[model samples]
Every structure is written in structure tokens, then in C-alpha cells.
Target chain A: MSNITNQSLSEILESIKSKKISSLELTQAYIKNIENAKKLNAFVTTTFDQALENAKKFDNKPNNEQLLSGVPLAVKDLFCTENVKTMAGSNILNNFVPSYESTVTKNLWNNGAFLLGKLNCDEFAMGSSNETSFFGNVINPIGDHLVPGGSSGGSSSALAADLTPATIGTDTGGSIRQPASFTGTVGLKPTYGLCSRWGIVAFASSLDQAGPMTKTVNDCSIMLEAMSGFDEKDSTSINKKKETYSKNLKDNIKGLKIGIPKEYRVDNMPKEIDELWEKGKKILKDLGAQLIDISLPHTKYALPTYYIVAPAEASSNLARYDGVRYGYRSQKGKDLIEMYENTRSEGFGDEVKRRILIGTYVLSSGYYDAYYLKAQKVRQLIKKDFDDSFTKVDAILTPSTPSSAFKIGEKTNDPVSMYLNDIFTVPVNLAGLPALSLPAGLDKQGYPLGLQLIGKALDEQKILNIGYAFEKNCGYKNEIKKWWS
Target chain B: MSLDKEKIKHVAKLARISVDEAKVDSLTKDLNSIFKFIEQLNELNTDKVEPLTSILNQSLRSRKDEISDGKIREKILKNSPKKNEEFFVVPKVIE
Candidate 1:
């Protein structure tokens, strides 16, 4: 019971069901852990009182009854939590609270998951590093002075620190998987419409998707089952039956064709990351899986295409945040137009402004065809690359990031360098595919290096099955020593 | 495309965001650098590819237009920074 915080979500459920530990006790343990890990800045808000209340309500319930009964889970600030401040890590929404819950979180709560609180993220889910958050960057619990890769940084750091049994994160251009990789956690970005985007603050509507970040692949599967479904509120939500991912988690991957995309190899990628990719191939190969070399020619254009499409959508989506409606407003303006300008200039962070400007410039009268339209057409090519590759393989394997986590301020000065962290991840979003990153090995600095498994559209089961096999055989350990304490 | 200060100012105006006079030069430099980086997309020949606006290519699912859920105007307006009685307050533009 003392080591309850270290248990996986499935183990916790088992413990609760056997009457070995009450739900309230587990909730208190996580609350204590979160209170002690403040220096990590993993949480923007901790709903401790409500968590205890919910745990008390489920203290006597049979755990086997509900999907995630009494599971203490954290939500990324990007998701609206009905009465809780749902800032998408921006000053503009610093005081904004939603009166409705996001469909994803609502699904979790309906399945009996208790709320641990809101986690930090990049402003409007913009940056690769958590440095763009207005509340400040979340520190990687694994090392001193390193950043937990972002937008979902707080969720990853909290899970790695054992402050929450599991957490939810939104992925747009690699927010969930990248942070999970940086923090030695497992994250799965389901197919674009697998989970509804109803109350999740929009980043790039086309790319924004919610997924599970957990300590194990098994937990990720169960959480995904509880979190995904077709919602009528979200127009883009796919009208399909929810997947029971846990039921399909098989350890055997015999004859499964895994594609190793040659385009994923970029210049100056750390030798350790490449070695981990090789190790992943060998592991799958030994598991009776055939490894095949494949090509995704439009892969290199993913980042630029993403930058264009994401910002253009972001510019349009974020235009609703005028001073009059909600959130922050500026009083310095002499007229209505000035007020709109002043409020936005003061409310948004530098990176956000930069992106909005890029979006505006691309969608401008003279440049629409060259930048926006060109990027959209290239996006089609990127998706075609995946569609062609998936025809030849069951799933694709690659390094999650070029390098492991670096110092907090290392790449802040260079915007393009920061954008490069998502090079290996953005293509999946572009194609609207499900992908997951599991810890495969540690780098030279002892930070976790993750191996990504990319699956075809609506084919998360294949990737999860492959991940289950890898998790069983990879021998990669992610247990931490509470360094943040 | 070189993003000089004037172009930066124009974009900012289009975006309805005010930039500090002192920061415009730095913003211009930043925009130019990012544009240069994105210029690599021009290297590829995409002659006949159609723009992919949606990933699913699934037809839009429309519902009969009606009030699916509402009657929460009080709750919705609760977060407004400046509100009077029933409407959000903003600086007068007509005057």
C-alpha cells in the first residue's frame, strides 16, 4: 500500500477492487505527491478537495464495475473542465473558466475517473518546449534544469513524478507524444476524430486531438477506451463504435510488417536516437515480425506544411477572443479597434503573436496561393506518403525525437530549432493517424529516448499490439527516484 | 518573401494585434527568418495535388439546425471581463 503511487493504473484498479486499498487512500497519496512536487511545476491547478470527495463517493464501489473507478487522473489545461479555469496556457484566458466539460474529460468522469486537476501546457499549444506557457515552463522530473517537452509537458511531468495515475493530453504537431517521450511516459495520439474536440480549446482544429498519457502501454489502452467515442456535439467526431483497446492488447506480433521509413533519418540526428531506432527494429524482428524498408517522400515537407496549416487555422480559431466577450481585456484603447489591438497585443505571448502573424501573412491577399494553398496541397502529398506506405506495412517505427530532453533555455533563441523537435511527429498529425511513443532506452545523459509506433487511420489496435509486444520485450525501465523532491 | 517592418506592420494590422513600436523591427527579423525556413517547401513540385482541407475527407455531418442545448446565457456571460445586465460591455465605436 505504501508503494501504491508507483503502481500502474490497472494495478491500482485491481488493488481497489480487492479491498486492499480504498479509493480515498490512493487519492490522498497522489495529492500528497503532487503537493511535494511543486518545484516541477507539473500542475497549474490541483482539484484536491473535489478529488477526495469523488474518491469518498467511490470508496465502497467495486472497481471492476466501472472503466476507471476511483482513478486519479489529471487533465491538460487545454480541455475545458466546467467551472475550472481551462486556460490553454495563455494570458488571454488567464481567468477564463468554461461552463461545460470537454467531451473527452466528461467521458472519463462518466466512467468513474476522479479529477486530480489541470496540468500546464504551451500557450494555445503552440511551442515544442513548455517554455511558452504563461505560468512558466514545466521542469523535467528526470533531470535538473531540463524541460519536459511541451504543450502536454505538465501532464507528462506529473505522470513521471507519480503525481497522477494517468493524465490526458491533446496532440497537435506532437504535443502529447513528444512530451511523453521527453518524460519517459507512454502517449497515444489517436486518429484525428477518434476523440471529440468539443470543449478542448482549439489549436489547429484539423490537427488538434486528445489522447492518453500513462505509465504503461496497458494503462494507455484502457484510458483510451474510456476517453474515446463519437460525440454529436463535435461535428468532426467520427460516427463509429468506440474501440476497446485493452481487449485487443496482444503480446504476439508474428508476421506483422513494420515499416522503417528512410525519410525519418535526418542530418545531425543524435547517434543514440538512431541506435534506439535500430534496437526497435531488432526487437520487432525477433518477435517474429518482418521489418521492411519503406519510403515517405513528402515527409520533409510536414513541418513547413504544419506551420502553415496550423497557424492559419489558429488565426481563425483564436479570433473569437476579443476583449468584450470573455477573458482578458485592455483598457488602454481609445476606440473599439484600438481596444481589440491592445488586448490581443498584451494578452498573447510572443510565440503566439509570431504564429498569428505568420498565419495572417500566409492568408493575406497576395500570398494565399503561394503559402496557404501550396502548404495545403503539400499536406495532401504528406498524407499520400503515409497512405502509400501503410499499404506495404502494418505499422511504422521511428525515433520519437531527434534528441532527448535538453536544458530549459537551450533552444529558446532559435524558433526553427524548436520547431525541429516535431519533425518526426508532425507527419502523423498531417495524415490523421494514431501513433504512440514508448520508452525504448536512455540517452547518454540517462534521459529516456522513446521509439514511436505509427499506425494507419483508425488502426490504433495494430500499434497498441506492437507496443504491447515491445513493452514486454524491450526491457526499458521508466521508474524514477523522486529526484524532484 | 522578405518581411520588412512595413510588411510586418501590415500583417499585424490584418491580424488585429498591436505591436509595440520598439518590437516591430525584431518581429520583422523573426518573420523573415521563419519565411526563409519555410521557403524549402517550394523545392518540391506539387503540380496536380489537391489541397487537403480535412484529413478524413469525410463529408460534413450536418444536423437539422435547432437549439441542441442552450438556456445558459447567465453561465456563459459569467466569465466576461466587462458586462452589464445581459450583454458584454465594450468601448463605443459608433461615437
Candidate 2:
């Protein structure tokens, strides 16, 4: 079990298929790892009993053709797991257990994956750090006090610590990528409509996309292949045949033109991150992939534009939590209006409340055109910046974040400073393109640094291929002392 | 302050969240700084660009208006904090 916990998802699947290890054995190993790694606060709920039961059932009758038979995986709490507490790291939905399963999780289970548990995340997926969660902040497995990133912080932490073989995380604005970058794991935010969002708690409807967070590039590709497809329930879901992403991971990146956006060269970027970016470029160049200078001119405006668009949509989407249908309700309120207000004020965290207020203000009558619409127009320009650049290159390369994982309380107090964490990752979300973040090197502090590969919309296979080539060169792996144990 | 007290109060009301009077001062400051930060976007010339609501550039895929989903009334009601046999119980609204 000790040796098995260190194996990749692909290795686990192969081992299970060959009967070298039973699904129940693997499940128990992960459950033990999760039990031991509790200090990281990676999971909001651990469905160990249910996972073991499912694993036993699968072991009793092995399924040869199933993609990930009996593989234990965790999902970010934002994805609604049937009969499981889907808190989304908010007290409002702390007791809310969905009777339905999110489309992404359902797909994973359908492909013979067993659920380890629901992972912790930012409250309503709002903040850049896991500190905003109603549950306490998730500690990075790399360092004791450092954050594991957010809102998919728990997903990344668990994957990095080997608590789960693979996990699912949703990226609204760099949530998945940044955390993966910080934790030295692989995370992909697939194209906006590539995966269905049904049953996943809405953060920003237009920006939310679910993808796989895994221990390796091949595992990420395979998990994405299982989790993606069209569902009529999600109107935005694209109607396309499911792709075998793992089969398409051709390590030949030769003749591929990778674009390096000049806007990513910020004035105050840490030297280590810059050096890692350079190392990433050199790796690609050595592999025969041409690096070209490109400009995403509207990149500077992405953060502000995201702030407006995301919160505006969030305010509308969250309007349902009014002490009426589901979630927490105020007990002291005497009347309907008071009940609504009291329930929300008490249920929402500070960051959630702040964003909702901003959203409400911007979408309010006189300010709608000035703030919301203005931001949308700028969002178009940001999208155009990428659209134009894609014609010259096959994919874009950049650092995943400005820095590696920071201490828990470092940026929590400063909202503006915290928003800058998503500086490199947000523009990709704005343009609705697929991006993968994989470990390129370690920072001076010994925490992992990640480099990103941004692909043209629906070009996930291309980026994964390039990522596979780079991943081979770096030989980067998540190695941590048994601190939490 | 970028947004005055009345404006903050109005926004809070619009958002349906009651703000504590004590927190409003801090909330105002936070919103002000955020608004000021976002004001940087005003410098960008977006006069010719159309508002991009959806990034996919794909039009809404509408289907026949039919009852494709149902039979989950019990499941829907199960999540409500307070619910009767079929309906959720909320505070009285009628006079």
C-alpha cells in the first residue's frame, strides 16, 4: 500500500487491470493516506466508507473495458455529489446535500472511478487563496503554513500529497491552474463549453469550466477525456464526440510554434518565476518547438474586467439562496424580507458578500452600462488579443502565477494584491481557451513553480501533447517529507 | 469615499444582504478601492468593440420546448430547510 500510494493514476489503473492489486486494496491505501494527511485540510468531507463499499463492489466484479476501474478520486466541493455534502466551502450550503450529481462527477463514476470525497475550496469559489473558505484555509503540502492555492486548493493539495490519485476541480479564474502550479501537480481548465456544468454550484456561469487535476500529464488527459461531453442540461455545452485525450498525447512537439506573450513579463515578477519561464522556453526549443514573441495587449485590463463580469453573474446566480428553496435560512427573521436579508448576511462570508455587493452595484440601473457593459466590451478585446495571436502560433506559453505558494495570511488582507495572483491565468479564461499548468521547476523556497500552455479554443489535445513533451524534460515530481503524517 | 453611505446601503439592499452599520464603513472603503482599481479599464478604448457576452461565439442551442425533465419533486423539496409534502415553507408574505 505504501508503494502503491506513490504510483500514478495510469499505473494504478494498469495494476488493477492486471490483477496485481484489487480496487479495494487501492481504495484502502488512499483512505489511509487521506486519514494521515488531515492537517493539510485538503478535504471538506471524506466519504471513506462509501468509497470502500464502492471499491469492494468493483473488486468483486472487475470491469476490463472501463477507463478508470476502481480508481479513487476526489472532486472539489463545488461539484454536487448526490447524497454527499456539497458545501462549496460556504456555510450557506454547509448542510445542503444535492439529490443530484454534477455532470463531471457522474461521467467520472460512469467510467468506473470511485469517489474518495469532496475537497475544500474558496467560499463560492471567489478568492485566490483558500483562506476565504468557511472551513479553515488549506495548508500546502509543500510547506506547513503556505496555502495550497484556491478555489481548487483542496483538490491540488490532495493530489500533491498523494491522498487521492486524481481529482476534479473547476476553474473560474485560475482556480485550478494556480493551485496546481503552487502544489507541483498537473491541472487543466478545459475550454469553457468542453465539459457540462450541470449540478456544479455556479460561481460565474460564463466562466466556470471543470477539468482534471492529476499527478501527471497523461493522467490529466485521460481524466479530461472521461469528464467531458455534451449534455442537453447545459445549453452552453458543445455537441461533440468524446475525445480519447490520452491516445492523442503524441510527444512530438517539433515544428509547433509556441507563443510567448510579452505582456506576461510584468515589472515586479519574482526572478525565480521568470527563470522558470525561461527554462520552459528552453525545454520547448530543445524539443524543436519554435518560440515566437507575441502580444496579448489587453492583458493588463483582464483582472478588472474579470472582477466586473464574474461578480455581476455571481450576484444573479446566487440570488436563489434567499432562505426559500435550499441552504441556510435565518431563524430570527419575522417577515419574508428580513428573512432573506438576514439569511444572506449571516450565511455569506466576507469575500462572497463583497463580490455580491460589487455585482449588485455594477448591474444596478445607472451603473450597468458604465461598469458591467464596459467590462464586457473590454473582455471582447482581451479575447481578440488571443484570437489574433493564435493565427501566428499553435499555443501560448507563460508562467502559471506571479509566484509560488505564499504563506496563508500573506495576501488575504489586501484584496487588490490578492487579485493579482490570477494575473497570468485570468486572460486565458476570458478568452475561453484551454490551458494546462504543469510543474516546471522549484522556486528558491523549495516550493514548486508551474508554467502554463494556453491553447486555441477546443485545441486541448495540442496543448496536452506539448505539455507531455515538456513534462518529460523537467522530470518534475511532487516530493514532500511526511510532515502531515 | 468613491461610493457614499446611501449608495452602499442601496447596493446592499439590491443584493438582498443586510449589512451591519459598523461594517459599512469598511465595506465602503473596500468597494471604493476596488472601484478605483477597476477605473483603470476606462483608459482602454473599447468604443468599436462589441460586448462579448459568451466567449464560445456559438449561438444558444435551443431545443423543442418540452418537458424533458420531471419526477424529481421529492428530491427538489428534500433540500429545502423547511418543506411540507410538496412545497417549501418560507416566511409569510401576504398581508
Model 2 CAPRI rating: high
Task: Please write out the lDDT profile of model 1 over residues A324-423, one tens digit for every residue.
Answer: 8888998898999999999999999999999999998899998999999999999999999999998899999999999999899999988989999999
- Those runs of model 2 whose alpha carbons end farther than 4 Å from true positions after fitting are none
Please give, for residues B7-79, the per-residue lDDT of candidate 1 as tens digits: 8888899999999999887887877888888988999887888888788969889899887788888997899
* Local distance difference test scores for all models: 0.91, 0.92
Task: Give a tens-digit lDDT track for model 2, residues A1-485.
Answer: 56898889999999999999999999899888888988999898989899989999998888869888888888899999989989999999989989888898999999999788989999999987899999989999899989999989999899888898899899999999999999999999999999999999999999999999998899999999999999989999998888899988889999999999999999889999889999999999999999999999999999999999999999999998987788999897789899999999999999999999999999999899899999999999999999899999999999999999999899977898999999999998888999999998898789999999999999999999999999998888778887989
Model 1 sits at a Cα RMSD from the real structure of: 1.0
Q: What is the lDDT of residue A21 in candidate 2?
A: 93
iRMSD per model? 0.9, 0.8
